[model samples]
Target chain A: MSWRSELQALRDDGFDVLDWLSATEEDDEVVVTACLVRSEDPGSFRLVRSPAPVESVVDMFPSAQWHERETAEMFGVTFEGLNAAPLLLPPDSPAPLRKAQPLPARLSQWPGEVDPAKPRRRQDPPGTPWR
Target chain B: MAMNPRASLELIAENCTSCMLCIRACPVWCLELDAHLEVDESSGRRRSSLALDRFSIDYGTCMMCGLCVDICPFEALEWSSELPPTQFEWRSE
Candidate 1:
């Protein structure tokens, strides 16, 4: 499914609430999943998904900004129109999720325990490790 | 920590991530994110843009399931025992 049309359809359904959006890379494509809940039901939901990155709903749903950023950062899919700077993955790190033999960092969380009070020191430090 | 269900979040200074996840997650969109994030000499983080200006926990409209707390990755936010003293009047709708 085209990413744009699918997202547009979500807009048509009036999915004003964003639940969660995540992505995974296939051999040659990235699949993005966006879940939204109906305002009336709140918890009862609908999910809008696509296997392509060409279509984008970042314009229709302003909140999709972060979703697209993380998707592009981790899965390497281009959101034809989203322009927000990357929110997670380091500014200088190469997107490793796109490689044929992607490194564990692409799928792995920081190696050490995460201390809520301390700075994150376990994530890849940058310099485009896989690029 | 089991907090009072009738609590207000004013003093918690629950800084919004501007990730807008709360707005996205809010069933009522009552949680509004505005542009008040800025440097505060009190807070020492070099980069000091906090999320929304201030979030109102519409006591009448909130659903106390802790979803808001769950979505806040910054830990700048938390629930409190009582509503902090407010200077602005709340909107009546």
Candidate 2:
């Protein structure tokens, strides 16, 4: 069945769109998830996952427009049928949230293993690696 | 290490290199650092370093996760047993 068919089935079964978002995994794969809340039980939610290059469901659910646009901007995923325009980022800006994107050199201390008592200053402000 | 369990955060501003690891590790994102690069031409070797103008952590939103204390490469942040004053004149700014 098509992705739209799955969403329509959920809608027919009395489910409402709660939230939609996408994330880039460590392996460089982008995954989009949508939460559908049961109308009778607001506390219960069903999560739906779609890998990158999936079809857009904005036609079935208008609320998914912004979410699809955001996923496209961050992960470079094309949401077919949605407006192909930058949502939260500028047009000239690169994909800053992609897993493979280059990061600032200063953020190399992510592991927290470096002792704080040492002077780790580098010759360059944020380009050269600290000794 | 022997440390006061009830102490708040202690910061050694001069030792900080403004690497921003602590800022990213912070769960609440309460720590803020305003820094810029400057060149030191006085010495034979011209070296550029970051000049931190303002470094403030909002205790109002801080959860004291201690990630900043552990991740600082320069031992610039520490935990002190003496907490900040409880009473303060509330300002709108």
Candidate 3:
């Protein structure tokens, strides 16, 4: 079944609490997860999806708005119909959590590059060859 | 009962083999280590050993989790009860 339909079904089944929503950037795509809970029950329901234009659950769960925004900002996941303002980082900042993202600190001179034994030979930082 | 309050992190340079286990284990990347290989042939046979040049921990970024001390294979890192001054520098003595 479609994720939207599944969410709607859960909501209809009295899953009133939207515990949390977040995303992780995998090697190829971003994975978005939403946790739902029912006050009557002790456990929670987790919904995981991998979509380029992920549907926004804000309409179903208002608390998902901020979590979706943060996930979007960090992993560059675009949630459809969710207009998010700049949260922790500036609007133009690169997606820091993406695997392809190059850390600015590693691009600069890293202290670990210094080798006391060999002055001529240099070692690249952890994340090198940004390409 | 006596409570030992955590303060500054101490580095026992002599015991440290520069294995870099602490640096790798640091979640915040606050620890930095630099070492070079030194070879000596004074005892008829050549012996190579890792000589630690510099080792530093950025207390500003350190959360004092004591993971580095616990992860040190050589027991090079330890916790000192003496509180560090506000402007104190973390240098390997």
Candidate 4:
């Protein structure tokens, strides 16, 4: 079965709800992702993701709510979900399918901490009258 | 028109530079830059529907998640002073 079919089958096996969905476009293609979980198996969950063009598995999951909307705006993927609106974007947005576009400044660049032991370049402390 | 009474709507249009980052970052589809988005006749590229128009925030439906301002590549969005302001000022290298 194809990825969409696999997702539908998984839904049939009681994975009836969608938790969220996200998409990222690469140089070659778009990647659509879905996170699935059910009430019965609260802790256990699975992720369904693939490169576009992705089929709308929205029919199988109602809570796919914002997930489908997000995928549409970020990657221009259409979903059979209720409405494909700017979930994380404005309706008047320009082409969102530019995979090479830089990520939002706040969302880009992971900053890690510096190693503590590597430094000994401390300048003299601020002047105090007592010193 | 109906945004949460609690959320503020402010637009810094000058800083917008006509980039649609705010337009593409709203989760609730509440932001509208009233512009003529047209398809380029020759290139078929989807260009602006209108020229530069003021952006509207539909508060009646807005979730006020701040994602719109967060995704704006330009500093075109003004924050509500009530909330902690996160602003990015661009400086030339």
Candidate 5:
């Protein structure tokens, strides 16, 4: 079933509260998850989707406006009908959370990379083996 | 009176191995550590050890979460009851 239809079905089944919405990068796509809860129940359900140009559920869940904006800006996920206004970052800034985005801190000289006693060989920065 | 008040973070320099664990574990990236390799050949056998050069914590950015104190495997970081000065200045010695 389509994510939109599933969300509609969930809304029909008393899952009225939108707990939170978040997204994570998985491989080349962004996996968006929305936590939904029933007001009378003690449990919550997660709705996951990875479709490109994910359909906006703002009409159903008004709280998704900011989440979609942040996920769109950070992970470069496109949300259809999202206001495209710059939220947290400047309009000219690149998507910072994307895997391909080069970290400015990584490019600069990390103090951990230098071993004063062993000047001949450079040491890798701790927790940054990818560099 | 509180038995264990978290007032200051003290570094036991003698026990530190310059492992960089505290710096990596810090959530705010407020900790900075500098070290160098020291080679010893007293017994006609060469051995290398890490010698700490500088370690500084930016209290302005640090949230006092104690993650660094708990993650220090060498017991280098500890909490003290002595409160930090109101107008504290951080300098790396």
Candidate 6:
């Protein structure tokens, strides 16, 4: 069965979404997890994970709108029913949290006692094409 | 007045080994340094030392939190309450 139906069934079973977040995974994919807490027992909670490009459960859970929008913008993921609006970040800014994204600094060498042989962050000039 | 040793920042520039531990500890990025290594002709050995070209702390932004003094591995930095009044020959603004 689809995750939308599963989330709805859980909601009917007195589960409420406490929070939601996303993390990058292997193979250039992302995972979105929802923290659901049972209404009868706030101490008991469950983490539900689903791969990116998954269907949005915002229609069944209105609180998922911000979460879905944030995940979509950060990981370049798509949600089937989500509106075309930016959230959390300015429109057109790079997805900084993604593992593939380049860091902001350009240190010529490591400072202090750090091992010099260890690879440092890439120092691409601004406006260079991103990988 | 007896100065409190733990309330102000001090630096013994000659004792610095330039390890840059204090630079990394600065939360506001107020510390800066430039260094170079060269062979000492008399000693016949290579030695590293800071150039003092850009080793300046922007007092405007420094919160005086003392993280830089505490993190100096070479014991070059210290805290003292004997700091003199701010004296400037000119003003930028």
Per-residue error for A104 in candidate 3, Å, reads: 3.0
Name the fnat for model 1.
0.00
**TM-score result, candidate 3:** 0.77
- DockQ of every predicted complex: 0.02, 0.07, 0.41, 0.01, 0.37, 0.14
In candidate 1, position B71 carries an lDDT of 74
lDDT of 3 by residue, A70-106 (tens): 9888888788889977699986998898878776555
lDDT of 6 at A64: 82
lDDT of 4 at A108: 25
Model 1 C-alpha lDDT per residue in residues A46-105, reported as the tens digit of each score = 786677556566667777788878878777677776784777767867775665655554
> Which pairs of residues clash in candidate 3, taking residues 3 or more apart in a chain or in different chains?
none
Cα lDDT tens digits, model 2, B1-93, are 565675577777788776778866776556766566778899889988876666677787677789899989899888888665432122112
What's the TM-score of each model vs. the native? 0.41, 0.54, 0.77, 0.41, 0.74, 0.58
Candidate lDDT (C-alpha), each = 0.58, 0.68, 0.75, 0.58, 0.75, 0.63
- Chain B TM-score of every predicted model: 0.53, 0.80, 0.83, 0.58, 0.84, 0.66
A103, model 6: CA deviation in Å? 4.0
The candidate that wins on DockQ is 3
RMSD of 3: 3.5
Candidate 3 regions with alpha-carbon error over 4 angstroms: A114-131, B1-7, B24-27, B34-50, B65-67, B84-93
Residue-wise C-alpha lDDT for candidate 1, range B1-93, written one tens digit per residue: 776654655324444345555544554334544433456566565665543444454555555556666676766456667654433122222
Residue pairs whose backbone atoms clash in candidate 6: none
Candidate with more favorable, higher DockQ: 4 or 5: 5
Off by over 4 Å in 5: A126-130, B1-7, B19-29, B34-53, B63-73, B81-93
Candidate 2: segments with Cα more than 4 A from true spot: A105-131, B1-8, B11-64, B68-93
Candidate 5 local Cα displacement, residue A123, angstroms = 2.4
DockQ score for candidate 5: 0.37
- Candidates 5 and 6 compared: the better one by DockQ is 5
lDDT of 4 by residue, B17-85 (tens): 545556555554455553333345666765533334445665765666887777777666756644323
What TM-score does chain B of candidate 2 reach? 0.80
